[model samples]
Target chain A: MGDIDIANDTVSADVVAKFDLPAYLHSQQAIVASHLESALEPRYPERLFESMWYSLSSDGKRLRPILCLAGCSLSGGDPELAIPTACALEMLHVASLIHDDLPAMDDDDYRRGKPANHKVFGEGIALLAGDALLAYALEFILLNTRQVPAERLLRVMHTLINRVGISGLVGGQAVDIECEGREDIDLETVEFIHTRKTGSLIDAAMVTGATLAGADDDTIARLSRYARKVGVAFQIVDDVLDVIGTRQELGKTPNKDEKSRKATYPRLFGVDGSMQRARELVDSAKKEIAPFGQPAVPLLAMAEFVCTRTS
Target chain B: MGDIDIANDTVSADVVAKFDLPAYLHSQQAIVASHLESALEPRYPERLFESMWYSLSSDGKRLRPILCLAGCSLSGGDPELAIPTACALEMLHVASLIHDDLPAMDDDDYRRGKPANHKVFGEGIALLAGDALLAYALEFILLNTRQVPAERLLRVMHTLINRVGISGLVGGQAVDIECEGREDIDLETVEFIHTRKTGSLIDAAMVTGATLAGADDDTIARLSRYARKVGVAFQIVDDVLDVIGTRQELGKTPNKDEKSRKATYPRLFGVDGSMQRARELVDSAKKEIAPFGQPAVPLLAMAEFVCTRTS
Candidate 1:
């Protein structure tokens, strides 16, 4: 690839208007899926790998990884350089899902239109599978990522780990679990939970990609802000879907938030109000990356997709 | 510190004879403890941090981190340089223990003479705490490790993650769980479980330290072989203690392996036979690292400690 100065790289309005988001998503999803398949081949202690792959292979929107690649491409870096990190993001996301569906946690029996990991592999293996995936994600990134400077890769590893730890997803989930069935939860508390629980990984995905691509600090910061807005909007849409969508459309049990007495965006704001909020966030997310022009098309479209996804 | 070529560094018999193993262990343990204490400070989302710190602060041998430092020191590197990775090793070890004690896993109600994590913090929070610790261990290494080349740090990360994932602890745990009550489990299978479940992280600890210290490939290989033997011996000692040691001495339930019908060294061979095997392995471990002479005192002493410890 030619050394394109990403700071000054721009495309005409006609080129930006011609972008096809669905095609972009489809192609990126295919690339991510292929890599994910080979990223963790089943090995000895076959059952454990089986359990890990079960959740990993189940169909879901490969949003985080796709966003990671998009961030790399937007910064004029080779998208291939970000593929391993992208795969790592998906592994982490699936791992969180498996653990979240455990009996002591959300206790859901289904995920992505299939039996949950624990339901099929039993809780013990399911839990270990989740643990394996979490650890392996880092291993995969370190082993497979090529041509990237070691310093940048270390930064990527640091970002991903930070987002997964107490300051981010774990802390958010703890508060969410603690506040379940409590009527005292406020909008601020809900936002706190959503931002960390869901938003942290989403932000990490973009930031890691940009950092790996050697994007300037300002560009990384812009992408991070864009991710933060979209992440919140994504969670709001999920809450709304859980309240209104069917099991078929949602792929898991619907109305679970109500059943668990969990506080949500729709609980505080009406469904219409929640949708309006998501729309506003999506618009703001797009605005955050507007300076990147045509290169930002995939990210802007993803933000819209997050606001509108049924499952 | 003056630059000493580790390959040529040696001590006379008089100095080696005067080395106080107990004092070395005590000092190293104290150093590791202090670092671990500051490694994870309590933060907001008070309950989550509380749960994490509760298990982490619970007293244990701190053996893994000490071994890491010993490996670094043996290679003529500053022990301080290895401290962060050493603490990461301990964190990873503690995280595994927390998860292992869960109801869905080992169902243990006690650990280190106190209620197990799940017993005190509910299964959900305990699980999350384990997850947080696992993720934070990597984060701590990346953020705290200094003066090491980024390539070495990445290699350390790769080594740690590889051991924690399916090929190591998780895979071993899975097989152990699967073979819980099976009479068909053979000596080879038992060794497989013990080696990976207990040995993998032990191997990672030493390897990470040596790698960070820029140990030669041959030196790393010797240390690795030393760790493998010591790790197996360590687990055998643990199994023997479960059979004969009191709860006060073991700091947990005794004979729980018999209760669970988990295959173990003592179960296959009597306690006498198990102890003999451990002694043999410890001797072999010492032989592997004998070339390092006086610098190998700590590691050699630790192997002996592993074979002889009551708990």
Candidate 2:
């Protein structure tokens, strides 16, 4: 309970100050990254393993996996049980990034201030790397997390696949691409694109951790609410950053959405309106965590941190 | 077991043999394709769904899923229990195909004599379609497969994901791409490439089905061997067909492997030698099933059928 108070106060303050999220996220990132490296070692053609590890180890915010760990911890499960699944989330996210950087998708040759996967590895290897990452992510979840109940594991699997699947993230991406350069795209269309493109995986990450902890249906539902709010808020922040932040800060080439003429929050809602929406969503997400008492404080603070940021 | 005999003998041989595998494959292909359609129904601009579905449902072999169902039956489980998992396998397989047809990968302009996914649906939708199929496949397995225990389900998951992951299909693909035009590449490299590229998923299909049916470890091992042999034989036949089969008969662009200067069985082993190896591997694979007695007949026959086919 005391941890909750400290996290709530300190976390929001730190975020407002733009305190180092990487530093905040570093130790766990190392842990998850190492686990991923170790998980992939038994396989062959060591170069391929190196390629995957190199792509993952590249600098970025470890938000999804960290959220997964937080979700599991909030549900009173050992973070270790969440480790593999958390890694899986990271891997899946990485896969999306790899594909997203291709010439046909974003056409950007740079990622994380360096050449994109396709640029450095060539389009063929880049494609294979993405496929490998996705396949391995599921493998990691299934093979690790040995202690989680089978039903719970199955639920995690379902959540993961559904979120990443066509109806969710993939479906969203397709529409986002199609809607590009189209002037008449509406709010509903934008919402559909963002929800599936980013929201589904983020929602999966939060709920998957709790599910692994054997959280009951009600708790699971609440956790999902928290995840949805945070997920949307995260994307809003992303859009805002594209409009306001620099490439050095954000890691990839900036203003991509605008340049691509893709629909964005700022285009749909003024910057201030989007900011307000993000804050409100974060608050709603925090409220969903109230029933968890103290254990969920991290999640709550994380939500607040999501919106109260500059970059 | 007696039912097996009845199915083989009493079932109209004409229907089974004269049955155009490619034609039959697409008829039920819609069932798996519909699964993707239903999942994405709620999206805005429903046109996105319509186009994505149009691309995926166009046509496919549906081999992996059918193999999964057949494998389950051979291991003494109801084919029905394997449906969801079969769907997953198909989704995963479809995902690979979608990506393979992309300009970044195989650079093909057509598949099944239709416009490629990227060409008709555009690159963004094509990428999304692949991702959607992959995710949907995993979800289908988790949600569907009710008869199996959780442990069995986990095993099935482990098999599927691992086979599809970097060390399996993806890894093989990377190596194959790297090996292109390397006339110096030897037989070991060729074997490594093919084994992981094709063998892993085939192994997963059979092993997962058997694991669900609670086959003993020994039986599981035998099934794996059977799958590996058939997978390699199938690949060899594919290589052979690339040289000899007609475009109309095979329903795909032929002789492209040689044109691409890709390493293949016919290139490494003379045509006659490749055919001989296919027979040997098939025979050995059938022997692995010898202990399963008559119940394993379909599996054994499938192994022979794999090598015997011209296409």
Candidate 3:
């Protein structure tokens, strides 16, 4: 409470002028990347270690982790205290990616410009490594998060459970997989995937950050709306990017959703229409968090950035 | 501490005589099955619900769940209190089996006398359903388990983490998968898979039950040893049954391990020798729990059953 003051939400004029999202994201990603290295120790069964680390260590935007830290910072929580949980979120992300990219799933050959984990570690190790990461991510939070109250951790677990379990990410992924080659998929079906699959985790990231900081219910609710809207916007933009962004820009294979005949925003709405929808969502998300004023700067900028950003 | 007394450890002579393990297991399995029917209420997207429940509802000996209940009973804890965690353990086991039988993993077409989840549900749904179960199992414990303290629940999660993560079940499964099709696979490799893969869950089951019931450290350690020994013995007997029992008897494919060239105790030790080793393990495990006297009878009987029992 001492850390969070109305004054803290008001930025000095000079400080406001110097704020830069790319620079902020770069610093946040660095923090998350370094913390991630320590989060997963390479033990015996070197293959599991190597397989898990390969995708983890590979370069990515670190968006979810950054979002988590950003939310914590905005809530006036000690950002440092959120590192373990932040890393856990990233680890879970990597695990989902690893499994999603397996031969049986999306069957992608490349991720972040590297041969997919299974392409290098073999399918069995890749799949098991994903399983290990998913389970270990939860365990890491249980074992490593400190200063946060136990109930907060339980809230975090609850957040993760809803986001990761059948009601959320898994369900979204199932629908996405099920939608493959079905051209009749409506806006509801695409929204089904966008809102649940990728959206749940992003929404959880914000709630987790706010929860860790012990923010008021009002703040948490606002952030949830902000995150939910922004998450779907992010996915909508992702679909647009796949159609227009290059492999170098996306840092992986592009147009894969189209190639798989998977239902996507671009397929349903067209690129321009999807981009328009994204901007609308981001605008809505920004309004939701506007009450925080200066403290909301990063989240607002993140929403705006999600509108047209490549990769 | 108050519940555990000298008298609590004494088994009534008639209770010992009427133990009737098969009957006992039958009754316990019935309890588990009924609880499981409600453990996961099917929800739509209907495919995900269908895929998850297909394997979960399949008939098999509810060994781990029963072990958990038994441990709670031995400690004079309300057996009902252990049900949630027991169901969680079973859910996790089913998840492992679902992932294990995938085309990318074990490639099995049948499990528990029915088509494997992957075979029936498609690889993607089976995989996601497994992932859903794994995450949901943890959430279910947190959501259910009426009287357990938070710290105790945390302990249950901690047990699951160590037992099911990379160091335990998934790690063992990875090694087992890796060891497939290799002529030079050693006894140590076989032991590695046996102890870590199947053994970890069994070991955790007992510990979870004990932990839920507030068993002392000594009892937990002894139960762990008992479970470890019995798990390997169970696998050995399973391998023996695979070689000797018909499909009608085993209720699933038999001799599949030999077909895959996977190493087993029988391949390393002759059938007679494997049988002897299982007996020795059961004997040693029984000795480890010998101090518990009457309280250990069910576990003891379980050990002997693992020694020579066929499917």
| A6-75: candidate 1 lDDT, tens digit per residue | 4664445445446777898889999999999898876889999899999999998898999899889988
Q: RMSD in angstroms, all models?
A: 2.4, 4.8, 2.4
What's the CA error at residue A274 for candidate 2, in Å? 1.7
> Which residue pairs in candidate 3 collide?
none
Please give the distance, in angstroms, between residue A138's alpha carbon in candidate 2 and its true position after superposition: 1.3
Q: How many backbone clashes does candidate 3 have?
A: 0
lDDT of 1 by residue, B144-191 (tens): 888999999999999999999898998899999999888778999899
| Model 3 misplaced regions, further than 4 Å | A2-18, B3-18
Global lDDT of each model? 0.88, 0.75, 0.85
Q: Best candidate, DockQ-wise?
A: 1
True contacts kept of 2: 0.91
Query: Across residues A74-118, which tens digit of lDDT does each residue of candidate 2 receive?
Result: 776788899998888988888888888888777777677777888
Provide the lowest-lDDT 10-residue window in model 2 chain A: A1-10
Model 3, range A96-209, lDDT digits (tens) per residue?
A: 999899877889988988799999999889989989998888888888888887777887887987789898888998998888988899988889888997788898889898
Q: What is the TM-score of each candidate against the true structure?
A: 0.96, 0.88, 0.95
